[model samples]
Target: MQRYLEGELGEEQFRPLRLQNGLYIQRKAPMLRIAVPYGLLSSQQLRKLASLTRDYDKGYAHVSTRQNFQLNWPELERVPDLLGELAEVDMHCIQTSGNCIRNTTTDQFAGVSPDEVVDPRPYCELIRQWSTLHPEFAFLPRKFKIAVCGSQSDRAAIYSHDIGLALQHDRQGNLGVQVLVGGGLGRTPVIGSEIESWLDIKHLLSYLEAVLRVYNQLGRRDNKYKARIKILVRAMGVDKFREAVHREWSKLKDGDNTLTEKRIEDVRAHFRAMPYEQLDATAEAALLAQHDDPIFKNWLKRNTRGHKVAGYRAVTVALKHRDLAPGDITADQLDHLAELADRFSFSEARTTHHQNMVLADVRERDLHDLWTALQKANLATANAGYLTDMICCPGGDFCSLANAKSIPVSDAIRDRFDDLDYLYDLGPIELNISGCMNACGHHHIGHIGILGVDKKGKEFFQVSLGGRQAESPKIGKILGPSFGASEIPEVIAKILERYVELRQEDELFIDTIHRVGIEPFKERVYG
Candidate 1:
């Protein structure tokens, strides 16, 4: 960075180099992406992030879909100092972006999920250590992402990543991984294909290394348009891709990279059980208070989630303020969250891919108290998975790559459907908005997806339906042409009217879309 600043390095040479370290030159300023390893952060790390946001950024930072934090206004020269502070907290920005292995994400409920096959965090940690600054895999054709999920339900969106690992057990009760390859979003969204039904536990790292080696060698590098691993999979077909991976794996399997029991146990030791109480979780007062306190009941219904422990419940503190941008938290709020983590969640807090924070170990009895504190901090919006709890990007306001604005569109939708009763009846929906084809906002996976486009330098919004990003990931289909910005809310309303009328007794929005298809939605909106 100093060499570039001193004019010894050209912009083209310095651009990729700086991006590998998680720095991006945005439209107005430099944005620094700080990787929070697998979305896990201790109280000290959270406080350090808070301090950085307060000191370097504009009093707030955006939590990205990759389970990382972005400070948008750091001075170029002060970055070293900022990174120095981050290192003191055992944090850095290495391999966060560019053509390298990005952060390895996993189920935020990894060890705590009730139906988990095995804890995947130890595996995730092992991969993190191996992938960081890996000399062999660095400078790949394009950026890469990996996700791991141990639960029966995939909350990690494993099917939408470059490489996905699902923990599994055979009839003989041997632990292993279900390896997937070639999944990605962006311009050409594709679901991953299973390369190996069950890879042995010992060969996990070597198998992953084999996959990356294939991608690095065979994947396209000449054209930026067709550079991702997904394109390569599409070009060669899944059968050929799997064959290549197996051919490569045959040579590297059971080598030095193979896992050992002691090493795996040592990595697992970092994520031992928290101090949890043994009492039964009646949540007695909270359930009883529900009769009179509608607000608490509403929050309880949406924000809090089930815990594996008897007395605990994981709480999602929503960051989707109606007035502000979604997935945004202020420096002061980060500080408050650090305090809350210290008091309630064992000095640890987690960031989710859904752009929310999780106090994963909150006592069920203390939920009301936690809700009160969150409300005070303006982080207590009880709209998780609701229509108003939308996923959105910074859009044209901040991103140089955006074609149109997104935050305003999101706010317009939230304002149009502000009634909690109406949203509750609408059921859980993933509504994602992207400012461009980059799909950073993950519009392709939204049950109701919105995209912004530019035609003749005028902004327009396009809508799609039926996309999902769970265990069964599917890209959304477009609903005819784009609409003027003013017409989006009514188009959305019309679509919802059809959903309300056509949905079965206990069907979700995505389920209804799948059952009925996009033809009905097209007729309602166009007519």
Candidate 2:
């Protein structure tokens, strides 16, 4: 029996006992989650993590939804030792695998986002320390996730996190956060219902503690699958939940744990902004003249986003593979990206939830050279946010939890729709694929949702339509019956062809679907 976790073992037989068949007895594996503060990491940190994975654990590390790295290896006995190594480099695996306070996540575009009111790094670092090794909330009913976004674009995907905090200012000009609770994904995915419209930053940690306490006491522990705080929030109405959280919050407010100005300043010191130089004009013109190719132009248009800087852009190296495994970057590919970040982007790389690597703070004119280098590295897939850029899980291929294989399905869809212009014409479509009912790929919120299911002995896919992820969040609706793997591409093609035919000029797929209704799409595809 796995008894050491419950404090029932001598230190001698530790490593061999804690991990039985790679299952760490909690969730799945003895996963080591490493924080990449604000999704920004030095190339050195990335290389070290890569080496750590290659040396200590599995050859691969999974980039989590919360912008952290989770390595699936090492013995539970060696966890303390692993923590010690991580601490040597100012990293830790504490609260990464437990029901206790987990790592706090923030927007990938924390500092550089053009739309941000202020950098959320200070807030994230402050909350991170408060949550780390929090004693009273160690044993909870279920896992909890928190995300903070300073951008209107919601780069952190705050709408779908367990506790989503959006930094905003009130009319009178005071900094505050708009908080959302209970949004989560798993067996049942839900957009978190809003609880607090505006709560000042000083009360952030205490308010969060109150909410967690309410959930810890009320959340269901009997059914592991139904134990998420979202279920609890839903079962007890939102208003009642808010009332309960307020009741708990009133007790914890301003009692020695109030966010002090000095404490905030201490955390801020650790996150001093990276040094940046003024853009060079001569370098910009030389870059443009060097690579005026059509492909490079498309890469420039789709892959690069506006940076807060005058002459720089944030480059997204999209891993939303046409048919390949999402978030699967080879070791060689990793090295190449690191080099690119060092040379072109100001020594920082960001890992996005869309499973893309971002080279933040790149000069606009140097885009062509960057593309040429990326092409060599196979990171130049000019489909950043397009339909071919499908967000897919390993499904049956790697994940033991999947009901069907998602890779092949994504591949089939990509192969059938190979024309880039046709994809561009379709415009701003989100196609998310999941192998099972568990929404790891976030199929529920995709413009075109594909869920792999088992019907009798054969695998099939069920399609959904009209979902979107911009400011106005809407869940997609199921289109119709399940189709065989072979039939998926044809069905998708039929739906898209119908969309192109019916859409007004410049109408996106999501807009066209919403304007024309799903019945037209369903009839065309199923007919």
Candidate 3:
């Protein structure tokens, strides 16, 4: 960094080095992406991040859909110092960028979810250790991403990753994984194909190595746009891709990369059970029933989820405030959230792929108090799983790659649909906006997807329908021609109106699209 700062390093030489360190030269300034390994962070780490934001950034940070945090306005020269500070808390930006393995993500509710089959964090950590600075995969054709889900619900959005692993148990009661390959979202959205129905957990690493080796060898290197593993898989066909992976696995399987029982147990030890209290379940119900405030009831129902433990709940700290960009939390909010985590959730919190934060182990009895604290901080939006709780990318405002600005579009939509009761009437909807085709916001999987496009150097927004991110994930279809930015909200309102007219009782927005097809929506929006 000193050499580059001193002008001793050329642009060609420093470009890859800075990217490897998670520094990106954006539209406005240099952005630093800090890896929050599998979205887990200690309260101390959160405080450290808050300090960095205050010192290096514009007093704020953005949470990404990949469950990472980004500092948007850091001085290029001071990024090294920021990273040094991160190191004190055992965090760094290694492999967060570049054509290498990025952070592996998983369910935010990994250990606490009532639906979990197993904790996926151990495997995520194992993969992190193996992939970090692994010489062989340092320069793949393009960036590679991995997601793991050990729960019945696919909260990790596994179907939209380079590699997706779903944990399952065999008939003989042995834990194993079902591997899916070629899944990705971008210019070409592809649902991952099941390459392996079941593989013993012991062979997890070895199998993953074989798959990477195959991609590293055969993935396109000539055309950057055609370089992702998904493109290669599509061109080769799933059968041939599976055969190629198997051939590679035959060579590397049962080798040193194979996981052992002791090795798995060792990593698992790092994520031991939290010290939970043995409070009665009925007591929790009674305590919750005491809250007469309808607003509190709405927040409790929308922003909190059931926990595996009897008297615990997973509280989602909504980052979707009208005053702030979606997924953005100020530095002060970071510090206060750290204190909240300490008091309520064992000094730990998890970032979700939905661009929200989760205090995974809050006692049911403390719900009202926690909500009050969060409300005061402007973090309790009561919009989780609603239209306003959308996943959006930092577009032309911050990203040079964007054709149009996304933040304004998101803000407009939020302002147009500010009524909580109206949002509840519409039910759960995934509205994702991307500045470009890169799909950083995972727009392709949103039930209502918006992509910013350039029309003769001017900005226009394109919409898609029927995309999903969870179980049975599907890519949304383009609704029609692009519309001006100012027209998006009215267009969306018309689409929702059609949904309301066509939907069956209790039907979701996506279900209505699927039932009657996108034609109805297109007609409504265009008419």
Candidate 1 residue-wise lDDT at 23: 93
Cα lDDT of model 2 by residue, 1-527, tens digit: 24666667765565333321122332344555676655667777667676676666766666655566766555666666665666666765556554665567776667887898878888987777777667777767877878888877776777777899989999999889999998877677788889999998789889998999899999898998888899999999899999999999999998766787787778778666567668765676566667768888888888887778767778888765542466667556667777888888767788877767788778877787788899997889888888888888767765666778888988888888788887777787888899988777888888999998988867889899987655776778899999998999998889888998898988888898888889999899877
- Write the number of the candidate with greater lDDT, choosing between 1 and 2: 1
lDDT of each: 0.89, 0.77, 0.94
Order of the predicted models by TM-score, top scorer first:
3, 1, 2
Clashes of each: 0, 0, 0
lDDT of 1 by residue, 391-422 (tens): 89988888889999998998898889899889
Give all TM-scores, in the order shown. 0.98, 0.89, 0.99
Write the number of the candidate with greater TM-score, choosing between 1 and 3: 3
Residue 247 of model 3 has an lDDT of: 96
Q: Which residue window of length 10 is worst by lDDT in model 3?
A: 464-473
The residue ranges of model 2 lying beyond 4 angstroms of the native Cα positions read 1-37, 56-60, 70-88, 280-290, 321-324
Residue 309 C-alpha lDDT in model 1: 84
Which pairs clash in model 2? none
Candidate 3: segments with Cα more than 4 A from true spot: none
